[model samples]
Target: MDAASRQDADTATPEFTLRSVLVGLAIGCLLCFTNLYFGLQTGWISMMSLQSALIGYLIGKTFTHPSFTPQENVVIQTTAVATGTLPLAAGFVGIIPALSLLSQETDGVDALKLSWLQGVEWSLAVAFFGVFLAVPLRKQVIIKEKLAFPSGTATAQLISVLHQTPLPQPDGLTRRRGYEALQSDDVAHEETRVVVEEDVPQDVEGEVVKKEGWADLLYSFGASAALTVAAYFFPVLFAIPLFGTHLAREWLWSFSPSLSYVGQGVIMGFPIALSMNVGMLVGWGILSPLAKLSGWSPGPVGDMATGARGWILWVALAVMVSDSLVSLVPVAWELVRDYTGHGKREGHEDDEEEPPERLVPLKWVAWGIGASILLGTLLVWVVFGSDGIKSWATVIGFVLGCLLSVLGVRALGETDLNPVSGLGKVSQLLFAVIQPRNVVANIVAGGVAEAGAMQAGDLMQDLKTGHLLRASPRAQFYGQLVGSAVSIVVTTVAYSLYTRVYEIPGKEFPAPTSFVWLNLARLLRDGSLPPHTGQFMLAFGLVAATLAGAKAHARATGASWARWIPSGVAFAIGFLNTPSFSISRLIGGVVELLYRRHLAKTHTPPGREIRLIIIASGFVLGEGVASIVGLVFRTCGVGAASCWGCGTGICAGCG
Candidate 1:
């Protein structure tokens, strides 16, 4: 390519046309809705983005020639993948409003359900605001500082591998003659240079020629389906058994003496699920048991359970708040130091580091934010404001919602922290502070605030990804708007239909919304507390264990003590994961070690070896898919029947 052509290619904004945006939105929405459907059916959060990224990579490689540079290919693949997966994120955002509608319908009271149009409006607004907020922050986090977003790094690495492989040259007499001549030469040398280079390896050339074909596609799809099935039906089988047993024991003991063992056994089967289960066990099981033992039982444990739940809710909220505050302090301090003369010498010329080209200008961000806010406000006014009391209260609620969102962003640096629980607590407290009638308003406001926070976080991630890919800021902002709109509409419709068709008569689907209620109940009963106590305790324990392990290793092995400590911890943690997952990881690690050992015997290209690792990642993805599918079937009451004699329930046939 000419220099001008190269310049244009380098500088030109990849066109994110409306059509492209819609295509991306559609794909994302489809994947998201599918995942959501399965999630609701099985209670597993499938990683949709991984699927999208994989598919994007395949498509990019298929369409683009091997001659394309790694960077260029990455740009194409990432954009495709990100766009394809946008709907899932958008759908999640829409779920809040949909749930709100369901609440209102069931309760015959005012709830915070935004109409389809309103949801879209709010999504657009959030997208716009997020773009602007993220752009300023990007310089600090990504470019200048280079905080590692591991996912992005992995994506970049994959692209590099795809680009580095050389396609086979067509065979001809000239090529044969040249090769023969070069091979025949006693000392092959480049003109004017006597520099010696290592011979190119065959394995390196093989990777370029080994294009992903039908087998890969079929394997990915089958693996995904199988993994999802396994995950859904046999979560316990995949879980760390010992932890599950402990949780079961602790929780069951609170309910009934007879069930304690069973509960313990359950805990023994699933470890990672321990944190939440143990929290519940302590709060409900142990506390209730203690309360009963003390003759202080005021009501049924379930009824009185609100107090413990509330306590935990407050602690969780506080932890999130405090963690955000602590993290931000250093970041903010650095920002100030950078801007002021404290860090760099005063009046020193600003280094000529290349100014990052603007992706989305400030003006477009303002427009998006304004539009989102206006639409969100309008939605609250209509759906929530049908009653005069509700309408007035909702107006105030909307303001509070916006305020809380801003605070959440500032406090958390991202809106992923669910504000609903905190909001619920606040509402419950308000019920005590204000009249009971106003409780509805508080709940509405809290839900909206939570939704806003979540959407904001999503927007930030999307913007960050876009910035990295060098996508036009305007296109990203607009794409988000379109993506969110599609997601809200599709998700709402899907949720409504699913709820109607698959509504379990008495059993409520454990939506994230329930956590809001749990939090609110907790707040009303007790109050807030520290959230990070458990994490802190865990950290302390880890440190102590590390030191102890090091000391023991030094005494026993006479080897470097510190080296053993990390490995010891890793081994223990690996054992803590579900046996299936842990085993798979262990096997992969073993294979990698073996490969490296063999490579040492015969000098092979490092790049070729790395490709094997990438391919192995597909196994992890397969496991995840299996888990999801298993959960879906189990939730739908299909159990092992859906897996065609793959045993019953979660662990019917498991050893």
Candidate 2:
């Protein structure tokens, strides 16, 4: 809060410190474990943006020197979010199971078996493609076009609020000026320098104590971690049910509370919650049950509903691709026009401020991608390999990946929907045409695009968060780059541990995305689908996808009524995963809505919303910790069947 501290705050020296990297890596490991567990459990991956900033703010306060800036916390979060999201985004869990399944199915496929080591390398390599794509495109898409990445924007707001410690510079009012600059949403550093040569203004209450901010963060962290640890051990050791269940399930049978799912609902708000409920209701309750009654469904009600969701999936993919085409035509035409001098070329705005310093140069990024590709090609050749076709496959696959990466980011910015799984099909179709018999080629080529597009889109989103915070792109790039390297080891361990403990694609963990990808690969190879697939109904899906895509395009372009179009991704995923999870989300949405109404009706106090949200976020994080501890004991061979007992579960009775 002093002048010397303010000067330190204004500089960027501490952004890449040892403490930042280590802490970021540690948090990234925890999130990597959490995301890996949940992706397989629910066919969805959790993000670490807000959670990282919130926790980083705590460390910045009680842990770090008073001069720690907002940008430094951002550096911490960039790495954490990168490590957490990239595995799922880059197709680690989804593709790995498919590879494992294929290795078992084919006679010589065991030669192509993906070890955990290969999994990490492949993830990192594909992510390299994403980085190359995002780095250059950040200016074009985020700055010039100004896409609406809501989550990223929200994170920027969070950073602004939480990192308002010890203001910068007495004479200049630097902290206040810097914040006002950030409000532009397309801000540059020059816009932020409003100097006032005077002593720093004091609050009405006099010499302001900043310890309250740290206290709030610390208490919230402690309470959340405590609840999480308690909930975790009790269920395993004492057989005391902690995971909360829903409406009628508790009356009829056993269940556990998933606080995390509910928290997701709270974050996503009503539209997502409503969509999930409707998807479950229509797909699981009515249609799937009816199909079962008529002998048209398979397995359980959830499994049977997946058959209908199969119908939805293809339609969604078709619609998504078509929507991409609709937007692409105009952009393509404009580019052509500009190149041909058929239209006036727009110049950069003279009023705009200079961009912040970049850490990784463009040349370095380009070369890094090219080199990583070559190394990746060699590794792939050495592993499940090729007839001199790996490099060719990688090059072609990466080209298409760049296109899909652009499209995916644009679509996500517009509608928060990116058909990441769909990106794999571009590779599938390309390989199918080039050499239909090359199964390894198909998986590798398609996997490249899948990983590249997903990562690129993820990077673009993160950059948007950075852009809003006026954080340096280079600093974030370095953070993520190191994080990706660290993840190669940690994620591999987590994936191996989970696979060993619980069989994926099994009764407990369905791994629905894995099944989808594997079946697609099968369809590409033999033009056949497993029994209960309803492959005959794909035509219906195609038509539905086209119509839905048209509707979405309309919605994006300002046809508010078109918002009624059911999201293909959400609909299919909601139905395919357990109905109870969706139900929990719906409950969270209801709670959030009611709380909002209460605030409006009674006019709540200043910190009320913040307090409630902190508690809720605490529960969400606590659930993640609970999951980690449970996994730890399970990985260590603790639990039923491991211990010889009157009851195999972890009770101490009857020893």
Estimated TM-score per prediction? Answer: 0.56, 0.78
> Best-fitting candidate, measured by TM-score?
2
Where model 2 places Cα greater than 4 Å from the true spot, the runs are 1-14, 103-113, 165-256, 297-359, 387-389, 437-440, 529-565, 605-607, 610-613, 640-655
Report the Cα lDDT for residue 19, model 1: 35
- State the lDDT at 66 in candidate 2: 70
Number of the top-ranking candidate, with lDDT as the measure: 2
Q: Taking the tens digit of each residue's C-alpha lDDT, what string does model 2 give over 1-655? A: 6645543444545566677777777777777877776677666665666667666766666677674577777778888877876657555566666566555354135534457777666666665667667787777666665666545655565565555432222111122111111111100000011111123332210111143444544464466556555544443322222332232222111223456666656655555567667756755555454555566544443331244434333333333344334434444455456459785335533311224354457788779778877776666666555652466777777777877777667665554445565556666777877756556677667777877777776667678777666567787888878887787777777777767777665544566676566555556777754344344235435644665556556854878655445544455555556566677777766776677678657855333444434445555666655666767876786654332322322222211
Candidate 2 residue 456 Cα shift, in angstroms, is: 1.9
Q: Where is model 1 more than 4 Å wrong at Cα?
A: 1-6, 12-14, 17-23, 34-51, 63-154, 164-220, 227-325, 332-359, 386-471, 502-509, 516-655
